[model samples]
Target chain A: SVAEQLTPVLRESKFKESGRITPEEFVAAGDHLIFISPTWQWMTGDEAKIKSYLPRDKQFLVTKNVPCLRRCKQMEFTGVEKIVEDVEGEDGWVTHETDDMNLNECAEEMTLDSSKMDDIEPKNEDEDDDDQEALDMEEFDVDNVDPSVAIIKPTPIATTKDSETDSVIHTRTYDLHIVYNKYYQTPHLFLIGYDENRQVLNIDQMYEDVSQDNAKKTVTYEAHPHLGPSMLAVHPCKHSDLMKKFLQIAEEGGNELSVYSYLIIFLKFVQSVIPTVNYDFSQTIKTT
Target chain B: MSEKKVFQYVQFKSLVHHDFWHKLSDIKLDIEKLNESDKTIFGTFTNLNAKNCLLELDCTSFNSNFKTAKNNFYCKGTLKNLNTIESFKNFNRNELLKKEGENLLRIIENGSACKNPSELISFIVLTYADLKKYNFHYSFAFTASIEPLIYEVSPSQNITDEFSENDIENFSSSYHLLDQQQAAFFIATKHLDIILLQNALDVNQRDMNLKDHNLDSTYFCFSDPSEFPYAAWILRNFILLLVKLCPILHGKSIKILSVRRDEKSSLLLSKLFFIQLPNKIDLDPINMKWTGWERNDQGKLLPKLANMSNSMDPIKIAEHFS
Candidate 1:
């Protein structure tokens, strides 16, 4: 009887038509699970009242006054090859020749007659070509070159053109499983993200969400035994702390909020890591 | 005594290093002096061997006629000789303590001995005597293993019901919990809240009626076990946090429950004993009940407790508290 009264507020989202969604569905909807409770309902058994508790904006969820990169757009290297070529030729030879000439001129000024005996060799074009070929061969040395090193080309940084474009953030999709950690007697979030190609996403990009000191303390390298050592994972240690903070904020509104409202608030806080993905915790799939 | 005194039950086990026996002997001498000064108190020491010793101190003579004092002391030779110890042959000697010993043995077998065995052993023995003198039921002993572990004396039924296969699986999977010593410490600290609650109930008796009972002024006495430093630190902080979180326990007098500086470890240990007025009012916002759901399968909807006809029935309240 209590389960019937508390289900609408504790497990299922108020916005969904189906009234229930599995954890897999929630992950598929691009939302991460911050917490789950089969019992311990803190809200009244009313749908409309629960819906009203959803956060209107993200201000309360995110950190304030921290200088963080709001969005990261990989700069397109449209003209990087031409730029690299220009840098190699102009930066290497021109700067070198000019510095040598300037030094020689200064030396001549100091000892005018003594330095004037040998005029600089009239611009040797043939020697310059030979020198360029020799440099090319050295740069392309197969025995000493690391092929993996060549793939990591540095991208040029560019400022955003306009406010709209600047605010457009890039985000990866993360699947969150809120497990009841019976050992700790607390709820824990197990998260794994993916790139556009469905490749596992590394957590190095999400370090900005946690303070530097906390980043060190919270992130632990774990190799799932069943999944094999290759299935290495970066786990955040303080899920209970995050859950407590979320509940505290929800309770601050004078009434206990539904799990949907809690989920929305959780997503807002995690937006610093996965900035632009539209998270829908209520998504349901039709069985064919 | 105006109120019946409850003796806090604690068990301490450390390595049987050479210096531990000598330090324990020294403590036996000191305890003898303390007993001579107070005729009502009596101390007895039994040297099982060079590595094993037992000290039993009784203060029942000093206590009022209605109260009872029970304490036990056990010591064994090096952890390597644990199988040879006669007391351990009795399978019924606190299963939780046995599990703790197994955990300690695993750690020691893995070659993780204490960095400073002599100091740790001395601290444990002194702390035991100090806590015993204060009417706290404390037990001290040694195992052959160098690795130290702590266990809360819990009801066997509760442990079986609460800890399932899922808990064991989760424990084995986690890197931190995989370490036997760390796992022992973690599990011990994690279960402390429930243990403390049970201890409170046992000490105060089963009577639930507290309409006009005094709500202020509560006291806690903590004895630090020197060997498991991490467990000691975590337990103290967890107790403080429990007080802060439990609405019924807020704004009561809190103190560092300890005796003598030399007897204390930077890491505090022992049973948490609280004294205060009975809380008749249902101050807890959340009430926990078994939903009859299977351990492996969490049901689609979380179950809730059914409304009772008489919410304030004393029987119901007592059952809930138990």
Candidate 2:
């Protein structure tokens, strides 16, 4: 136990700063820093700024949900091929199995809230084709929205009796994110499961394959490992080893001096749920 | 060094709760019945101040983990002098095996012995308030007794063989006291005055239905006189004397300091947890430097350094307090 407590001191031999460091700050500071942010919101403006600010010599490690940083190039590791296909045979997700039904309905609710926007369209007469594509991406077509969007919906808490205290306790669910590493290949998406007390129950690899719709060119359905072959699949890239190592080091339980572990867990959970397209982090680095 | 006084000890004082108004009325009636010759002996009335006295309360919580054998009173010589595994194995292994093995086996089978799961956890609450002309100083301490139920499919028949009423009474009182001593050390070290101890068993019963208050109860001691010589007298007398000799140190304090084994002291953090009382009493309040003291081989402050010192009178150490 004492040896375990000394890990923060061991990790500090390589760094100048001491005490606790946040997940975002850690990713920005260290070389070979891995980013496992699953929330697409991280892909927008803030991440772009961080990408620009990162040192050129430093390697940017990404697991999932990476937006195209125009500056950095992806580093696709040799060996495995990246494929997007719908994995077959499982009844992906049922409405009953949905953790939160309200979250599942959020896209419809958002579209209803923005129905007024439809009336004010075409204000820019000189809009280019690229501008149209961007606007289309932002629009919420509830019917066409991915079923996986339901995963983010907030659920009402439920209470259960604790045999220990003989008291009814409302169990809280924790969001876990992980990046699975397999050495030379890209890191795979990992999901964490916890029992009632928030102790980690399981860690599993999540892979997603993609398939096309009637349009042929527009890839629609992706096969997720957990949900099987479905319209929404989570893809695992080959170069996710770096991200996995980062998570492993964080979870090894030495210095709880950072909240980066919690952040990484949350990120990987999101990645396992949502598939990002041909976004190879290693390739992004080489191009940069 | 100040001379330590051999103070007289008194015990079993009655904490009288009297209705003064009723007493005054009775005295007036007595005065009217007095004869003319007895007129000189007149009843008098005066306002009296209530005295705030030292109070001690004792409580016990049950931890199943601390359970010993039913008939075993004294610990084995081997268990008592245990240091290493080799020494432990050489001791009476049979006794240890019977108790430890049975407990472990019970857990494997699930706690079928007790119907109520709530009996596994319990709490004892005690409150002590000092009466004073001004604000009274209140202190509280709590000890938790954890008793894990050992479950076994085939439990010993001796367990189910209910003890006779007298045997139950004897074991409950004496055995409970023996069990409570470990918790008492924790409480004393914490310097907590008012304690609430809870056990896994919910023993709440209707007061009206109860006959003897002591039955099915842990001991409760309030306004205990015995503690004066043991605890309160030493603290009060030493503090008062220390203040009298050094008037400027009146605002200084002596607090209970708790140090865990592996705690580290740092510039940004202090390893001590200090709970300040109503006021602080400074004794040797000024930390002065001493020239003589020997460090042990382990670099620890030697316990007998002052006794082994060569100096006739040690100088005041560095005044870190003042």
Mind giving the per-residue lDDT tens digits that candidate 1 earns over A199-261? 233344433333332343433333221111111122333333454554554457555544344
Candidate 1, residues B130-216: lDDT per residue as tens digits? 222211111222211111111222211212233345543342235121222221121122322211222232212223412122432
Candidate 1 error regions (>4 Å): A1-173, A201-214, A224-237, A258-278, A281-288, B1-322
Model 2 chain B poorest 10 in a row by lDDT:
B41-50
Scored by lDDT, model 1 comes in at 0.25
Per-model TM-score on C-alpha atoms:
0.19, 0.19
Q: Report fnat for all candidates as fractions from 0 to 1.
A: 0.00, 0.00
Name the docking class for model 1: incorrect
The regions of model 2 sitting more than 4 angstroms off are A1-101, A104-156, A160-169, A172-184, A189-192, A200-288, B1-277, B281-322
Model 1 residue B291 CA deviation (Å) reads 54
lDDT of 2 at B298: 25
Error of 1 at B262 (Å): 69
